[model samples]
Target chain A: MIRLERKFASLKENSKKALVAYLVAGDPDISTTLELMHQFVLSGVDIIELGVPFTDPIAEGPIIQAAHDRALQANTSLDMIFSLVEEFRSKDSETPVILMGYINTFLANSKALESIHERGTDAVLIVDVPGESSLEDIGIQNKNIASISLISPTTDNDRIQKICMSSSGFIYYVTLRGVTGASNLNEDEIQKNILNIRNSTNLPVLAGFGIKTASDARALSQISDGVVIGSVLVEMIQELSEKKDYKKIYNYLNEISAAINP
Target chain B: MDNLRDLPNSDGFFGNYGGKFVPETLMFALKELEDTYDQLKSDPDFLKQIDQDLCHFVGRPSPLYFADRLTKHYDGPNIWLKREDLNHTGAHKINNTVGQILLAKAMGKKRIIAETGAGQHGVATATVAARLGLECHIYMGAADVQRQSLNVYRIKLLGAEVHAVDSGTATLKDALNEAMRDWVTNIDDTYYIIGSVTGPHPYPMIVRDFNSIVGRELRDQSIEHFNAFPEAIIACVGGGSNAMGIFYPFVSDPEVQLIGVEAAGSGIETGKHAAPLNDGHPGILHGAKSYLMQDENGQVIDTHSVSAGLDYPGVGPEHSNLKDSGRAIYLAVNDKEALDAFHMVTRLEGIMPALETAHAFAALDHLSGKFNKKDNIVINVSGRGDKDINTVATMDGISLD
Candidate 1:
């Protein structure tokens, strides 16, 4: 089993909800991202979602898009990100690292899957590639990293079943129809969808997209396995980086962690 | 070619290219569109309606005129112009828009959304939506909206709402991103009319089927005029709608050569051009696996061209497949070459061609004496030059009042 499954199993045993924190790999610079990864784990982040910055992140709103641009401007590439993951893995191997980005980045690298495993990545979530396409179809599934799939509110029951069966890592449920950083999350609708997905698979379903506040994460954790925070964390990284204040990031994540953990 | 026509193979892939590389929220919408198009394509009544609209509404069989002056200038092969520029709305865009609007109406969609680069497709879609009495929204990049102000006004004048996208290079790709977000939000009632032969499966197929009338007409017109098929067919390829339209019917004809011209702004060596097939590698962008202008990290690079319509980082997946299979030849024409062709065609033929189409005409200089005297070469004049008049004048250091 991949590190994601192991982490989730442990979380279930401890009766704790997973606190996932997302950070763009090369935001501002690679060293900052490296420091933030260690800081994220230190602040009780159960899962670290590392975003490989892409030029066209259609699913993201302005905040994350700007983050990606900043990362790209810093000359962050997949190889650089993999090296960061390798460095991070040398110190802390317990936290699961999931590399999330558009499909083209992965496809561009010939040994992407092998390098992913070599760098000690636990999982990968390609935002643009739907469930209809499998990692095996692209000739890269045996690298031991879990290929995660997304389940959205617009996903029909039949597709939900298909995606759940094919999905290896935790299923990411988009809480809203809009892109990342969009508002208007409905707890009831998310709960119903999570229930529908849970019926199809034993894998954990984590709600993401538009989960801003601790209350929002707390409300979502009541109905689902966990809540994955993205835009809010990414925004905080941008703000804190400008002030050269890394303590605020740690403090902010600690607050979110405490809210979800309790 | 007979078997090639039955491609995408239920998985929406065209030979390792062209798959549904979109968010999960849009999968149902794509599947719905595929099912609807599959059912409607074979319906005789629906086919007849589309045919009638092509003939009466959009003016089908846009002439295959012999470019006497251009041929004399080339002094090599006899040249012919497939006059798609004469279509209603002044471009080949109306052909695809008319078909998609009919499809949207048949599917009971109440609203239409589209993304535009130079605003040609936006105007075409808005015109059709207005004709069909449906709510229309067009997403155009803020930069494009500024560059193509006339087309922006044209879209608004057709009673469609224009959303200026201000993210990610502020160009066609960004506009497409915004459109996709809107479709995901309002998939139930809104139908997205993709401008070109790119995007997720069924979309490429649907757009190709709708626009293939250009090649079908060329096949008949060629026989009538020259008593044989033209030795070569050329069209500009930005996302490859016009090129695909002219190349599809000729795919099986081994004797007829299909050439796609791509924009090379400044030059391909400068790393500032939109010639994906020439300078790019195979990668996925804009929902399809195709040759894209991207960096080593797979991030799509910003593309440049004198024509706003051709300034896209990716080409249609079918074009990529064709390029790989050696069935079609792809070439690049720099800004200077294309601009020269644009002026030459206008002066010689007395017909102003769109900047995108000028790329096709520019390829003639590259061919120089390659064809026999009797060999005929047909170029698809994909659009009129009116939208580009101001841009051209400004480039020529002349103020257009």
Candidate 2:
């Protein structure tokens, strides 16, 4: 089984929800990202979604966009991300790592994409290339790397199925109606959307976007198989990376993990 | 060869250049737009309404004047000006905005949002939105707001809210990003009126169709006046709306040459210009894959131009496709040449051109002696210089105060 499937299977068997942590690689610096990747898993992160910074990340809100800008300013490239993943893989081989970014960054750099599977990257979630588009559509042919698709609250029944038809790993259900880090999550709407998505695909649905606080994660985990924490954690990284306060970051993740699992 | 007008191939791919590369949240909205446009494109009533608006409201059939002195000064082909600057908003941008605002009303959208570079599009969008009694919002870069204060005040006077975007080089691209974010957040009642022949599928197609009135008028005027199609048609391309407008009708005609002038701020070699077709590679930005100026790391780089309108890092995707398929020729002109052309046109033709339009005028130097004296050449005078006079004065070390 792929690392994502195996990890989900293990989480299901243990009756625990998956906690996915996302961070922009090389935000403060490369070495810090490498250190945080390992720290994320230790704090009960089931999967790691490393942001390959692009010049334009339209899907992101200001918090994560700033993180991407900082990461790009630090000279982070796909090659650097691959090495970061490889370094993380050397210490921890069980956790799944997904590279999340825009289409141009992946398609324009074929050398980086062609070797992502070999470099321990398990999946790719391109924010822009969604709904009936696969990696193959863009001439990317690495079958080993699953292409994750996002389904938003605005997605209708027909599009949900179409998006799922081309998706793997899991379906990312954007809990809110806006970009990443946007606020105001109506649990009723999120639950209804996730249920509609579940009707279409057997693949695990991971709720993300606008999700903040342990209570939010725990509440969402009840409706979905897992939860992906992005902007809030990215905000924390931006605030604490310079101080090297890994424990504060790890503790925050641990609180969310414990909240969702318990 | 195979009908350039029939391009984008239903999926919005202008030969792998334009596509719906936006987030999944926007897919439904795009489909809704595409479906509505597909239904109304052939509707006679819709067509008639657009024509009436263009004729009465926008003051259409903007005169194609013979630039006698400019033609004599250049000592080349007979020069004609397709005067888009005479439109209601003082530029060709109003043509697309008028069409889009009608569509927004047709779709029952209550709020209209747009992004602007030089603030021309913002003012244009505001003008239409006010006429239609819709809530209007315009996102402009902080830098652009400072540079184009006249248009900024004009947009506000038209009762539109101006959101100054301060992120990502604080320019046009950043304004576009902020506008998209606003649209995403308010998707239900909001209709985003994209200002260029850029963005996802239907936008490029729709904007081109609306603005193609320029080319259609030129075709009729050419036969009535010059007795044949002009030897060459030239327009400045920023996001490529005005150029695409005038070039679309002539794209399939082999007799006419279509030339697009891009801004070469400092120069292409200095890695500061906005001429993506000349020095950049194919990449995706602002919801479409096109020729983009970016670093080797794939991060989009900042572009430079004295004209705020042409200082974007990416061109329209169709321009990229046209450049590749050899249907249209693209040339770059530096700031100095554009300034020279601006001054020359102001003095010789008694018509001051926008800095963006000046780039198209500057490109004429490259094509000098290429055509016979009797052969006609048309340049799209896309906008007036009223908004750019301050920039020109600043560059020349003059204070209006």
Candidate 3:
């Protein structure tokens, strides 16, 4: 089984919430990116989403795109990403690392998702793949590397059911109708979407997008099983990578994880 | 995952180029298009609709005519012309436009908007929309309106609202700017049917796929009629859809020489040209990175040519890819050479080709130095020359008579 499922099942046993940290792979270099992934888990990151770099990433915020651009400029390939995941397993195998990226890069890189079943990667979140066309249909729904899903404010009720039914991992509930980092929380809408998603499936619903502040994470924690922060973590990388140290990113995510718990 | 030619990721693009790139909000929609277009490409109903539309409406299998007089002028082997102008709306634009209108209707979109240079794109869009019963709007420059009044009337009569753009230069580029704004704002209900095989990602792939029929037909027809493939396949390159449509299939055939002729305006050495592949550097235009005519600061430089259709600052990414691979060769033809061919085609074969076609004809003359007269070359005569009558009349310093 994927580490995410093991972690979620353990969360039910321990009666605790999970903390997910998202980072763009190859932001600085393969070595530094690998170092950052280890630090994320050390800082109590329950789950990790390593963003695959793409030439054109429209869905990502400026900070995330900049990170992807840097990674792409360094000529980082999918082989390097899978190797990073495998390395993550050498030290600690408890935390899950989901490979998240645009469909083009995913199709360009991954020969067969099943081939990487034991590569230590947990799940795929192809941002451009539809709910109706799930990972199971494409022969990639192996228990070791299932597919996570993103539910937007624009997704209709029928499609939400389709997504919840097709999705294998915890559902990521997008908080707004705009791009990443474009909007803050709409409490009522988030609660309503969560309630609707809750009625559809037993999957743990994590709220992401625009959870930039500590207080935002705390508030979202009150309503969901986990809070996912991507752009904020990437923003830290952008700020600290200028000074040649990504340890600041580890500290920043730790702060958000602390806020959600308290 | 099926055939490389299969739908959804046809030409290897999802939503045709409008794939997921940004925030989570837009990701699902683009994915829907990606998944839908792929499956739809092979669906029996989808294939039937597209085939029926092309056969009865847009018209299919444009003729392969032997340009005996023009071929004899070059004093070469037999040169044949694929008559895309014989299609319902005239030009190869209808082939893709019709397919997209069907796709738009299938996608449940209600309105259609198109951008035009010299009104050919507008005419093509309006023709498809009228046949499909979809609401249509066309953005054309005020300058193009004055030049192509008949075309404007043709589109308007087909039940489309023509928005005369008064923007900078008031030409095709400005018209496209307005059309993009409309698409961005009303994307929920509108489908922007791009004219050429340029733009970001999927547009290059989609427009090229739609236009590739020209090449597919030519490939078979050349074999059926001549019993062998021609030595060269040539076409004019604007955003390079027609050229790419006819050139892409033959690119893999090493024996078949593929050439794209660019509008060299006065002369390439003079610095005023729309010869992007011939002169431009790699840069961004309409989103995707490709060969572009830009200045030192990377600002897009305005281009000039006798044909309004060819005056663009960039070529498609696939062309850039093709150029890098050396699978194809590009050449530039000046105004004078194109004009001379313009008169030659008119006098010899009674075919008044668009100024764009004149450039392809000029390429045949230019390559006479490279290949022997025995080497057969085929030119894609994209459109009729009626739109250029006034421009051609004022130039050459002579009357129509």
Best prediction by DockQ: 1
Docking tier of model 2: it is: medium
The regions of model 2 sitting more than 4 angstroms off are none
Stretches off by above 4 angstroms in model 3 are A1-262, B1-30, B397-401
Tell me the TM-score of chain B in each candidate.
Answer: 0.99, 0.99, 0.91
Worst-scoring 10-residue span by lDDT in model 2 chain B: B1-10
Best by lDDT: 2
lDDT string for model 2 (B1-401, tens) is 55678887899988878999999889889999999999998999999999999999999989999999999998889999999999998999999998998889889999999999999999999999999899999999999999999999999999999999988899999999999998888899999999999999889999999999999999999999979999999999999999999999998898899999999999988988999998899998989999999877678999999999999999999999999999899999999999999999999999999999999999999897799988999999999999998899999999998
Q: In candidate 1 chain B, what residue range of length 10 has the lowest lDDT sum? A: B1-10
Which CAPRI level is candidate 1?
A: medium
Docking class of 3: incorrect
* Clash total of candidate 1: 0
lDDT of 3 by residue, B23-73 (tens): 335434444555566667788998798888888886687889998887777
TM score of chain A per candidate: 0.97, 0.97, 0.94
Clashes of each: 0, 0, 12
What does the TM-score come to for chain B in model 2?
A: 0.99
Give the distance in Å from residue B306's predicted Cα in candidate 1 to where it truly belongs. 0.4
Model 3 chain A, poorest ten-residue lDDT window? A104-113
TM-score of each: 0.97, 0.99, 0.61
- Cα deviation of A101 in candidate 1 (Å)? 0.7
Interface DockQ of candidate 1: 0.79
